[model samples]
Target: MSTLKSRLDVVEQKISEAASNSGRSRDDITLVVVSKNNPAQMVLDLAEIGVSNFGENRDQEAKPKAAEVALAGKTVTWHFVGQLQSNKAKSALSYSSVLHSLDRPSLLDAVGKAVADRAEPLDVFIQLNLTDDQNRGGIQTQNVLGFAEQVLQTPNLRLLGLMGVAGLDVDPRVDFDRIRNSSEQLMRLAPDAKYISAGMSEDFEFAIASGATHVRIGTAITGKRPY
Candidate 1:
């Protein structure tokens, strides 16, 4: 097997184990391989191994990479998962099928406008700030529900779910609980929005138990990314 195929098998094994331990089915969680700086060829290699979902952090990088993959006749689900500036919203909307980091109202407005103009119904996740760190890009926990409502009202933007990263200081389980609670709040407003995209390579098990339907994993599967 090729290196990408071997690595994919390991990742699949880990996800199965994590799901089994959590009393959830292996199919319940979708793994979104983060291909931030990785090349489009590597993404294509992973796709051959049955990885259809991938995520990227920057607009400039994601835009060209996504186009290249599409041009090569590969169908991959692209997720935008970074701090988005309003000016970059149009470019992000062009490439990403789902925007996973909608944290602020102004950013939401920008995305809404872009989606409306494009006439594409884009899936969006409300990023929640589960930690005390102000530098993290997400809406404060107290404002999640309100933000979900705002997201729901946006034209051509579908509020698909919530996303969060665990804080460094707290236990992974505790952080996951916070994310679960916030997800519950979002569900109250948008019943159709059912995804909770939390967890990484380190804490995906906890995140699965806490009800994460999607997990973004990188290094564990692709090996260390090129800096």
Candidate 2:
């Protein structure tokens, strides 16, 4: 078997075990393999192996890669998983079916305008800052619900719950628990918003146990990134 395929198998096995340990069905969790700096050919190879959900981080790199995959006739769900800017809202929305980093309310109108004429509404996650640091990309945890309500007010955007990066200096369990609680709080306002998109390749096991419906895994599945 190819090395990449083998790598994918290992990650899936880990996810399955994590789900089992959490007393949750593997079906309840969606593995969003991050393909940020990876080549489109690599993504196609993963598609051939039944990986339909892929996450990309940057607009400039992601747009062309998503186009390449589409041009090849492969059915892939592209997610934009980086910090978003209102200026690139339209272009970023053009290639992504989901944006995992909707931390600002200002981009709501931009995203709505971009998808206004489209047949489908865009799925967005209100990213939250889990650390005490203010330099991070997510909205403050306390402000997540307020921003989520704003997202709900937009006509063309669908609130898909919250996304966050665990603090580098903190414990995985703490961050995951906080995120799960945050999801519960968000649901009080937006009932349908139960999806928790926390965790990464390193802490995904803990994340799954904490009620993460979606996990963005990268190196564990795609091998080490070149960039």
Candidate 3:
């Protein structure tokens, strides 16, 4: 097997084990390869290795890279996982199959406008900031339900579900619980929004146990990224 393929095997094994331990089907979880700063060729390489879903955090990079992947004739789902500004929403709408960071009303407005103009319904996740830190970009827990309600009402947008990151200072298990709880609340508000996107290279197992349908993993398969 090629080196990248070998690494991918290990990661898949870990995911399977995590699912087994959690008593959930491995197929229930989707792996979203985070390709933020990675080159388009790397994404193509991953696609060649049977990876069909990838995520990027910056529109400037993600927009073109997504186009490149499409041009290369690879079938892949591109997720935008960043704090999207209003101005960049149009560019992001062009390529992202799912927008994973809808944190504010202005962003929602921009996305609604962009999608309406294109007449495409984009999948959107309301980011929840479980941490006490305000610096983090997410709808506060208290406001999330109302915000999610609003998002569901927005035109040309499908409320896919919730997304979050474990707080830097909190235990992964604890944060995973918080995220799962938030997801549960979101589901109560919007029953159709079933996706819970959380976890990364470190705490994906915890996330799976907490009912994450999607996990964003980096480094483990791609190796260390250059800063």
Q: Mind giving the per-residue lDDT tens digits that candidate 3 earns over 85-138? A: 899988887888899999998889888888986556898889998877787799
lDDT tens digits by residue: candidate 1, 103-209: 99899989988888666689989998886777878988998888888888888888888899998788988988888887787778878888899999888878888
Each model's TM-score, in the order given?
0.94, 0.96, 0.95
Q: Write the per-residue lDDT of candidate 2 for residues 80-170, one digit (tens) a residue.
A: 9998788999999897999999877677778888889878899989898887778777888888877877789888788889998887888
- C-alpha RMSD by candidate, in order: 1.6, 1.3, 1.6
The deviation in Å at residue 199 for candidate 2 is 1.1
- Error in Å for residue 67 of model 2: 0.9
Q: Give the TM-score of candidate 1.
A: 0.94
Q: After superposition, how far is residue 62 of candidate 2 from its true place, in Å?
A: 0.6
What RMSD does model 2 have?
A: 1.3
Evaluate residue 83 in candidate 1 and report its C-alpha lDDT on the 0 to 100 scale.
86
Q: Write down the lDDT of every candidate, Cα atoms only.
A: 0.86, 0.88, 0.87
Question: What is the Cα-based lDDT of residue 183 in candidate 2?
Answer: 91
- How far is 148's C-alpha from truth in model 1 (Å)? 1.1
Higher-TM-score candidate of 2 and 3: 2
In model 1, what lDDT does residue 109 have? Answer: 86
Error of 1 at 94 (Å): 0.2
